[model samples]
Target: MVGRPLPLRDLGFRSTMELVAEMPKVVRVCPNGKGSVVLKGEA
Candidate 1:
């Protein structure tokens, strides 16, 4: 294990777009701006 696991609320996220859209405004203020990632769920 490395970083603390993402919160369970994050695990239940439905779509990458939804996640990207839902990110806090402060986080989206990064110099690099909004980013996207694919979230895979356990079987």
Candidate 2:
């Protein structure tokens, strides 16, 4: 999103929502880089 569109296509995705849906498999809900919650999370 910040640099190029090719990477998204390379990943075989056409939308941001498609990318986001796969995020949880590779990312955790906690461990925020700045140590704050922009959105609520379950304990």
Candidate 3:
């Protein structure tokens, strides 16, 4: 979703998995900001 850890934590998400659990529509996460896919959505 986002490229920074602070933003994710600020959103009340303990981890990427936690955020993914809440947002099923999130297809992937680009944490490195280099256009890489960090995590893939299960939903």
Candidate 4:
């Protein structure tokens, strides 16, 4: 949340693991979760 919001389009062609690895320490991704992960906020 300290920087500009990452647009969904920027995530295109990237793998989930790639995104997860690039995420900040405060961001958590649950690859095993039952439902899709939702990103809440304006971009």
Candidate 5:
């Protein structure tokens, strides 16, 4: 079966398509009122 949906950080377009399905502790954190997403993961 297909795994979890790929995160935005691992999404890209290149000469070839490689999926970096690294599961991270994602959270909706607004650090100092900045971004909305935080991905503490590996590549």
Candidate 6:
């Protein structure tokens, strides 16, 4: 029998923050006037 590796969805806070910080800069805007900016990336 062959074993497959498990996929990791969440990397927790430390790793997640690091990844977010290293991500490319993007222009985020609130079109609905929600006063919140969101990161835009490839779908």
- Best model number under TM-score: 3
TM-score of each: 0.28, 0.38, 0.41, 0.29, 0.16, 0.26
Model 5 lDDT-worst window of ten:
15-24
Q: Taking the tens digit of each residue's C-alpha lDDT, what string does model 2 give over 1-43?
A: 5675647677888875566556765544444688763332334
lDDT of 3 by residue, 1-43 (tens): 4764556678888876677767657665547778655776557
The prediction achieving the highest lDDT against the true structure is 3
lDDT of each: 0.49, 0.57, 0.67, 0.55, 0.36, 0.47
Name every residue pair that clashes in candidate 1: none
Name model 1 segments beyond 4 Å from true.
1-10, 24-43
- Which parts of model 6 are misplaced by more than 4 Å? 1-15, 25-37
| Cα RMSD, each candidate | 10.4, 7.8, 7.3, 7.7, 11.0, 8.1
Clashes of each: 0, 0, 1, 0, 0, 0
Model 5 per-residue lDDT tens digits across residues 1-43: 2696545455553221223222223322234556443433433
In model 2, state the lDDT of residue 17. Answer: 53
> For residues 1-43, could you state the per-residue lDDT of candidate 4 as single tens digits?
4697645457673565566556656456554576676433333
Q: What is the clash count of model 5?
A: 0
Q: Between candidates 3 and 4, which one is better according to lDDT? A: 3
Over the stretch 1-43, how does candidate 6's per-residue lDDT look in tens digits?
A: 2594323245433553355555556433324568655656633
Candidate 6 accuracy as lDDT = 0.47
RMSD of 2: 7.8
Q: How close is candidate 6 to the true structure, as a TM-score?
A: 0.26
**Any residue pairs clashing in model 5, and if so which?**
none
Candidate 1 C-alpha lDDT tens digits along 1-43: 3687545466676654456556655234233344644433323
